[model samples]
Target chain A: MPELLPFAVSLKGTENAVRDGLAQAMACLAPLHLNTDDAGTVELVLAEALNNVVEHALASTPELTAIEIRGSHGADGLHITVIDCGAPMPDGTAPLAKTPNLDVETHDMPEGGFGWYLIHTLATDVKYSRVGAANHLSLQLPVGV
Target chain B: MELTSSTEHGLQIVTVQEPRIDAAVALAFKDRMRDTTEGGIDTVVLDLNHVQFIDSSGLGAIVAAMKNLAPDRKLILAGLTPTVDKVFRLTRMDSVFGVFPTVEAALTKLRA
Candidate 1:
């Protein structure tokens, strides 16, 4: 199959923005006709990645925060790069994708800290970088190959 | 964040009427769950058949809901779609809850 043109979606750094951006990104992938599982994987990974930007990277920025998502499908898989004009990751690195401990007591169970884990588990080649004034996250979802 | 509840056979069934339970509504969903399941039956079944998508935040809210009813009441999960099931299985949270294929199946097994 021929290569599809890369699609980019610009969004604000907000929860509702993430939701709307995800819907548009998924719609852009419709041409690939990805299976249900693949579609879901793409959507979930994007949601987590974008949420990280809105909640963490852009947390302190009260000014207008801009987030851009670019995606392209190829033989290897779907390549996604999320760019944001926000604070660089702490220590200039992304947090390790460690799965939260589920062995704790019921009341002590973790209610958060699963975003990066899900992104790492479902997506491959996860990379994070600080480019000047922006944070760039790129990953590959093994779908539509 | 529309949740409908009904009680049957001494079990409270709470159904999520929305298509998603992501960050956009995670907190609201959690708060609504606390209100809906407050002082209900000992066992609560959350129906997720209509929900096609769930992110980590949404998963966290569900976990919070279950924890909110801890040591007294219990929260069970039913009608998980494939995508939602994938999240639970990947996170290994499926082991933490009594997951059923459908609400009917959950009610049958829980009633027995």
Candidate 2:
């Protein structure tokens, strides 16, 4: 299926690059005519995906250092694909979503591990694959559906 | 992220002036929040009315800030935009933190 108004950007796989990728992705999403709520959804989901690349994939393979984000809006909804020539997913599978221990004691609350949880919960049609030495992740978010 | 703080009803309210809080500023945000919130009232309310977006890192930063307060102080979040609020709810952090729609509401609750 052909994508509507496709946009893509490539940068180093680092935290700063995730920031830049988010900005560029926002620019790409500008013309998609998304409502404010949908835009915010895409932004949050995209940030989580990109930041995962920076923190896990990129951290593992500093030598394999290119992160590419490609996205488009179409009849289905907003679709995003993040490609990184960095580390593959552990066990070659997307991490299972674990509900954080929300009912913990005051002193035992968790400070992290919410990234994949939000990504899985917010985005639809989420997928991850390892192609050779590259990691490919794709996510879709509906526009006012 | 630019943050401002004030005291209301014996609770410290800190407002985040930035629209987005993500990996880019999570560390800086935590450090600055620690500094701004250090040595104030035992209870603090984070005002995020201006923050329209937050990622896992930003959420973790807020949690980290809260944990940094430790056994002595408390951290609450207020004025979360719908998007930010959704993230919190989806991640179940809403159950972990006391979230209010407005700073005044949080202050009122804390006072009572």
Candidate 3:
């Protein structure tokens, strides 16, 4: 632990609160000289993560779930960790995003496969861990930038 | 997030004046865009100046909206913060939608 700042927030993952919490985190982290976008990026990623927890992670069980985000700075890079107290992913799901359709092909049904895609695209590094029914996601960024 | 749209020289500029559009609000975003397009607007310029974060669901919703308007109308994205830009680039969405430095720039190009 290289002097990390931890933030813990509990909410219904109602989208708006997740958005605000992400903004608040960015405001606190980006000022450290990590060039982060003040736009829909955070909202998109956090929304997906929070939603997964709210819908599938806890399966609407209302287990008094909470998300813990941690940020730290060091000579290596900027570290962001999101921890959710919920169920593990279905069998073998990981943090990596699915393959994107790059051929500009038309779709019969225009839905699915965009959220994690955007998250994987924006985050320099992402890692997911399931520890005894907990989803621990960490996103990192280069500090030199 | 509430989406407000107005025309600028025949261009439909949709502005989302809320903080975030994560998964919970992603469907609302798509619904609003659908309503905006169904209202007879063709060209769209999505303004994300007020947004700070966009999770996977949020990004998916944006792409979904663009697809919904495809082969008929076009969608242009504007006012992407550094994080937002990174997301697009990483997901290769930089190629999916026309991105602009500002809304005015996107409109200018569309008019040209």
Candidate 4:
């Protein structure tokens, strides 16, 4: 008998709780025998997405914030789904992929706004949808490829 | 994040003693960097040789630390792991800062 493929975790969407979520996700991934780089990719992508939800989406409604993280192994690689009942993307629009403005002088270098860029770059097949009150984000990473 | 600082060839080298610079310690890392770099030399080299991971929050903290420095001061990075290096390159932050292969290289550039 083998274990399950898709495992889900429901947690309070708070910045403080992200570490625990990441740990749990890693634990679930431990059996998959992902290499260091692949594992890091998983961790970083998940962290960025979860942090975005906690920081931006759940910023105001901290009381009703609930984040669900689910991971399943697919033929391509590992698949992650993050569902959160937080604020929709401002103006009812999904976030588009935009590169950070790096063409700046030393004095004009940016301090933040690198989160989504990293998320979009590192994860493959990233999709975001605002479903009713929940934001559903799907991302995948191919292992050893 | 824990850091140890020293002055070498007129450049301040701050070594991050932690392995990961994620959201948990990004703020504290920035604060310590500010305190360390305040009223110091104009050029600072951050040693990330020990750091194997850096998320966007960590990157932002580094950028903030750079901004918090006194006028004309620069923050340079050195000894990035492959994973961490990719993060910088992917976000194109590599273009904004001078990233060296080693602390020595960063210092030599400063010295030269």
| Best of the candidates, TM-score | 1
Tens-digit lDDT string for candidate 1 (A1-145) = 6466899999889999888999999989988888899999999999999999988888887248889999988888999999998888888877888988999999988889999899989998899998888889999999988
Candidate 4 lDDT score at position A140: 84
CAPRI category for model 1:
high
Model 3 docking tier (incorrect/acceptable/medium/high): acceptable
| Regions of candidate 2 where Cα sits further than 4 Å from its true position | A1-3, A60-64
lDDT of 3 by residue, A49-84 (tens): 666666677666644666666666666656667777
Candidate 3 chain B: worst 10 consecutive residues by lDDT? Answer: B51-60
Tell how far residue A106 is off in model 4, in angstroms: 2.3
Kindly list the per-residue Cα lDDT of model 2 for residues A1-145, writing each as its tens digit. Answer: 3335778988787777777778887877666666777877888888888888888888876545888898777777878899988778888888867778768776677878888787887787888999888888999887733
Global Cα RMSD, each model: 1.1, 2.4, 3.8, 2.5
Clashes per prediction? Answer: 0, 0, 19, 0
The Cα local distance difference test for each model comes to 0.92, 0.83, 0.68, 0.83
lDDT of 3 by residue, B2-99 (tens): 88988888988899987666666888899988987785656888998787656566777888888888777888899986666766687677787899
Chain A, model 4: TM:
0.88
Q: Chain A TM-score for model 2, please?
A: 0.90
- Clashing residue pairs, candidate 1? none
Candidates 1 and 4 compared: the better one by DockQ is 1
lDDT of candidate 2 at residue B94, scale 0 to 100: 88
Q: By how many angstroms RMSD does model 3 differ from the true structure?
A: 3.8
TM-score of the first chain alone, every candidate: 0.95, 0.90, 0.70, 0.88
Give per-residue CA lDDT, model 4, range A1-145, as digits (tens): 2243789987778766887888888888867777777877888889899988988899988658789998887667778899998888786654666788877665687777887777777777888888987898898888633
